[model samples]
Target: MPLARRSLIEAAAARFGWRRAYGTTTEVDQLLNEQTETAYRDAPDHAALATAKNTDALTVQPGVLDARGRVLGEVLYLEGLLAGARNRRLPQELIARLEDVVDHGHELTVLLADTVRATAAAHTAGH
Candidate 1:
């Protein structure tokens, strides 16, 4: 495809994608924040976070916050991308794979958060 065509397609993809993926700006930003926090939390523990997955398709298991201000999972960042591009004619296989990654990330994030909280509680009690 020509540069112009490609740019148009990409632009269209982003515009249409964002519209279809999230209902509003607030949701998009919230999801983005969730994803960011997961990254920050996981950085100190490389192995645990590296195990999380990613995708280019859509938002699968987006990050979630529980009552305790703990992160639940890996926060599939691309899940937001995928959500934004839901209207795009992406392949089914890609979508499925992305969904799987998102779910896996979510599970991992939750486990890691629990571990961190527990560890902190233990440390506090010991002091």
Candidate 2:
């Protein structure tokens, strides 16, 4: 499923659980907001990698062994790459992304609430 839809489902499920058990809309809304905000805050960082095209700096010597031990010539490698690169940039993006994620989460929570309200109304009308 699409990432956004999956996020919605998870939030909706949590909200439904809270509402069904406690009949508390406020609590359920809070829970849904918290969950969804977390998800958006954690969205993948595609922007940081925009500079990844600089991989041309790598110089791979001919004859590198693959996992099967087969020799492969001329592998394109990334130069000046750090093992903890992602970790380093994550902190930089965290606060900004957290706010973005929170906004998205709020939208998701609102959408979920509307859907639930509509579904319940439909069921009530049918009955």
The digit string of per-residue lDDT tens for model 2 on 1-127 reads: 4557756876798887732342577756766887799898987664555345323212111111121122111111111122233446546464455545545645554554555456556556867
* Candidate 1 lDDT by residue in tens digits, 1-127: 3546745765788887643366787766866886798799867764455346423111112322242234322254657756755668588776787777778767767675675566556556867
Lowest-scoring 10 consecutive residues by lDDT in candidate 2? 71-80
Candidate 1 contains a number of clashing pairs equal to: 12
Error of 2 at 89 (Å): 14
Say which candidate scores most in TM-score: 1
Per model, how many backbone clashes are there? 12, 0
lDDT of 2 at 18: 39
Please provide TM-scores, in order, for all candidate models, with all chains considered together. Answer: 0.39, 0.27
Task: Give the CA lDDT, 0 to 100, for residue 55 in model 2.
Answer: 35
The candidate that wins on lDDT is 1
